[model samples]
Target: MHYRRFGKTNLWLSVFSLGTMRCLAGESNAEENIQHAIANGINHLETARSYGKSEPYLGNILKKLPLPREQLTITTKLPPTPDSQVMDQWIDESLERLQLDYLDCLAIHGINTWEHLTWVESPRGCMQAIQDALAEGRIRHLGFSTHAPLEVILAAIQTNLFEFINLHYYYVFQRHAPAVALANQKDMGVFIISPADKGGRLYTPPAKLVELCYPFSPLELNYRFLLSDRRITTLSVGPANPQELDAPLAVADQDGSLTPQEIEVFSRLETQAETALGTDRCSQCYQCLPCPEMINIPEVLRLRNLAVAYDMTDYGTYRYGMFENAGHWFAGVKGNRCTSCGDCLPRCPEQLDIPGLLADTHQRLNGSPRRRLWG
Candidate 1:
């Protein structure tokens, strides 16, 4: 139940916020679980306009609960639309669905490309429309959620228009940490999304990682790792059912400090990882980037690490399949595209055999060529 200054908002948000992305699942005690989480000091409830039925479901639960309006912090992301009128309609609909007078925060959901940024800046765009809502007292703060490239994300943060940001940054995907630090420097709130599930699916963590993070579940380690950094404001925990809240609730009660023993464990884990994955293992340093094949080298290699080191070959294969479909959001090839011209090898500080790793990664994770997500 510990709270921290949510950047420039100055709101003392609980380190863990209740995310409403998966609340509509058929769980009998879903509402009661939400009430319990609220009772345990989770004041922030975050949702998006496009998260299926989550907004309405949470609205019904909040209406039935005894909590007052002033005691709760509600946030919802307005789906990005090029048409200003449609954006207006979506914002109004979100307000109606949430049954709230004013949103504590409203974000432009999935601002994932430079084109999206351009659309937001266009005359008939959501930015002005949302700001109009802001001036009318419909929303208290303006921000955005993005799954864009690191450079694109940095550009958005540099704009200085957002009061906060919701982005992905976890133990396995620390590449976004520099952008997060920039947000901190700009005095903007940073809400990390889906740390457990998207953060390497730690909820059902591989046995090796579990042993590596001794004394803490992989989930706890991931949660604590993000919280240990002072720059991060809150982590969005999207619980699908009542049972899903147990470990997260326990994590929330923790002090969020990494003890000496934990640090030693992490160090040992890194060493073990080097030993297991060998010299060819990708460190995801991005130094060997700018691949000519439009391939996301680090991404494909990390998938290989999942298979070889973490023993998550099935998950790795699934994620590798996602590359062809991820498109702009995660632009990459499935490692087999490497022509082996020795382009990336000389640039690598670790002298990694990039082409060989790519071949192995493709072989390990490209089984049956699963269809892309949203294809």
Candidate 2:
């Protein structure tokens, strides 16, 4: 594994940092995975209080081991709720859950809008709570994670309040590239979350994406693509299993940059993919599982992305066909049946706008004259 300094913090962090989302589900031996990662020299372990028992699970594992707290960097997040009292309680809860006296880094989870940032900066706001935590020695540093548009990220950075910022980035979703560069210029630590979705999805892309990525794993190519830019300080992996961890670590260990041929391949693949898929971010992970509407979420999104990326409707008819009875499936609570209740939004490992995306897809696939549905 390779390590790099995390911007102005002057702390060395593993290029491949372990994200705690998958670890929370209790699918694997939490203790073993934590020990194995630390044993393998992964010094950075990121978790969130909202990650469904992740903090508590990690807390249990750590309490059993003799690992030095100083040697490990534990990062967690404060929920983006407007309730200051709730935020404070959650912070204390997170500390207790992680069995730590203080967090190395505590970020404001999911700063999705500029208004949210403004609210955070206001009096008695979340940022103030973070400052209070820092004063009380409960948190060492402050940061935030975002899935908003690049402009929102830029706006947040310009506020000059964050020590670091986590955002989606990879070879395929280069929209955030300029923002990453700007963050580096500002000397802020840049953490790239889920390169597999941001990068890997494009690497092993669908048939159309494969034609775009050419000779790379769409995965390796995406990693190489991100590594080509030195501004990225750490790349967080949501490894469902140990095998998922190995691929990126292997790539990080390699010295030197992408070969000219690889670079050319990336360019060609990117263009081909854009020509084929339209949007650059969807990874088709199929995690929006058991679609309530039988709408084939991943497939429909894939076709939509292709239509937008490639500017061709070659797959539209087939995509619409899949959604033929989507309403029936959704009616009983299956696919595009989101009620805007905001439950699944936070549960999503990808942090996607589940409701909004579903609504848009429903309209596009079932709203036209040829496919109109009576409400």
Candidate 3:
């Protein structure tokens, strides 16, 4: 597997780390998959308190493995809270469940809002407890994982407190590009979260995308795309079984730079999108904003772009269904909430019919509310 320097942390990490959110006890081959990932040189194993039973399940597997503790890097996360004592308890609980004396990294999980950022920054809040842990040799490095918007993400990086960041940034969703750049400038490790599943659900990609990414599956292309940027430290591969690890394993040895032919495939994909979308294509300039109902017009339109251009109806529907139900993690109203006030029409450079397209997005993508993969 290819290894890269994880920014200011000074640790060399595998380009693909094993994310343990899907490592539940119910999956019969979970242990085997973990073993397979380790055997293939994935030393970093990441889990969170919200991922039910993952910590203990991984702990059991680790206990049975022949490798010594120092050979592996372990990370876990907990939500930020105002109370330091409570934060300390949560950290203790995670460590106890993992049966580990110390963690290589600890992330303040799900800082998806300004309030969460405050909780971490507040004096005598979670940061104090985390600092105490660091001093006590319980945690070697501190970081945060977020599903927040770009503004929030940039603000978090500006704090200069974190050594790493786990976030969503992949081929299909590049909205957080600035955040990645800022993190790199800050000398922070940038770990991408859920590239295959949340990265446009490439595991069951549309045929058009498969064809566009010739000589590689859509999954490999997405991983390669993220790896192309040296700022990105790792991509989380949340495989549910041993077989699910094969796709990432195939691409692990690669240097992540796109060849000339691969660049042509990306150009082709863009051309197809432009051809299909025409003037309706959203540049994601975000000029149209401050929706009365808090609808994320750009995101909705991006989903529409996927559904219309790439035949990603399943991915569009799945994400659209999470609009309101996902709380801070998604933080938006459905496209149907557009008031048609025409306020955004004047702000858009493309002068697209913002409300009409939003209504159409609602028609095409809206479905039953779906919760996030983990709490």
Candidate 4:
């Protein structure tokens, strides 16, 4: 396994960290799965208080495993609270559940809005309790995970209060690229959340994506894309069983550079997208903003682009259905909510039919409702 310095935290973390959201779900082989991952060099285990049964499951598994405590890094997350006392209780609860004396990392989970940010940065809010924990050696590092808009993410990074950041910056959804760049500037560790699953659901990729990726599977291609940017520290891989770790482990030694084949695949993807969408293609620039209906026009349209260009209808539908269901984590109304007020029309340099395209997006990608993993 290849390890990278996780920004200012100064810890060498494996490029693929084990995300335990899907662990202990039903008839799970938790011990074998975790042990296999650890044996193959995935030294970081990430869980959350909200990932039902995950913390306690890890606690039991850790006790039974023969590994030393210091050999692995364990991290957990809790949402921000209004009161520092409540935050204190949460910390104690997570520790007790995990049966750990202290945590290698504690991330303020789901800072997905301005309000969530306020909850963390307030004078008597979670940060105070986190600081106390840090001073008392309960938490070795402080970080935050967010699904907020780019502005909110940039604001959080600008605070300089965090040693690391966990956010979404996938090969398909590069909207958070600026946030990643800023995190690198601040020397903050950048951990990508759910690249294979949330990042276009590459685990079950479409035919076009599979074809574009050529020799590499869509999952492997995405991993290579993220790891090529040295600023990214690690990616969360949620494997259900021992063998599920093999795909990511195969690409572990891929250094911080893209192969010539990778570059060709990237070019192929872009050219195909442009060719498929023609002049109506969304360039992903954020000029069209301040929608009257609070619709995330760019993201909504980008989903359409993916579906239209790459035949990624299933992936598009899965993500689109999570709009209202995900609350602040996704942070936008669906494309069906566009009122055709023409507010975003003039702002769009592409001069695209904003309302018509949104209608088409809603038409093409509408499906059963979906929710985020933590939602």
Highest lDDT: give the candidate number.
4
- Report the Cα lDDT for residue 321, model 4: 96
lDDT of 3 by residue, 1-375 (tens): 999888888888999899988877563466887899999999899999999888888888889889998888899999989999999899899999999999899999999999999998899789999999999998999999999988889999999999999999887889999999999999999999999988999999999878878877889888889888889989999887878889988888876578887788888889989999999988888889878789999999999999999999999999999999999989899998887888898899999998889999999988888998788
Query: Which residue segments of model 2 deviate by more than 4 Å?
Result: 198-204, 207-215, 271-375
Clashing pairs in 1: none
lDDT of 4: 0.90
Q: Which lDDT value does model 4 have at 193?
A: 96
The weakest ten consecutive residues by lDDT in model 4 span: 24-33
- Between prediction 1 and prediction 3, which has the larger lDDT? 3
Residue-by-residue lDDT tens digits, candidate 2, 114-180: 6777778778677667778889999888888886656778988888888888988765346677788
- Candidate 3 clash pair list: none
Better of 3 and 4 by lDDT: 4
Clashing pairs in 4: none
Clashes of 4: 0
Would you give me the overall lDDT of model 3?
A: 0.90
> For residues 139-241, could you state the per-residue lDDT of candidate 4 as single tens digits?
9999999988899999999998999999999888999999999999999999999999889888888998888889889999999999888999999999888
- Give Cα distance to truth, residue 106, candidate 1, Å: 0.9
Cα displacement (angstroms), candidate 3, residue 330, comes to 0.8
Q: In candidate 3, how many Å is residue 17 off?
A: 0.7
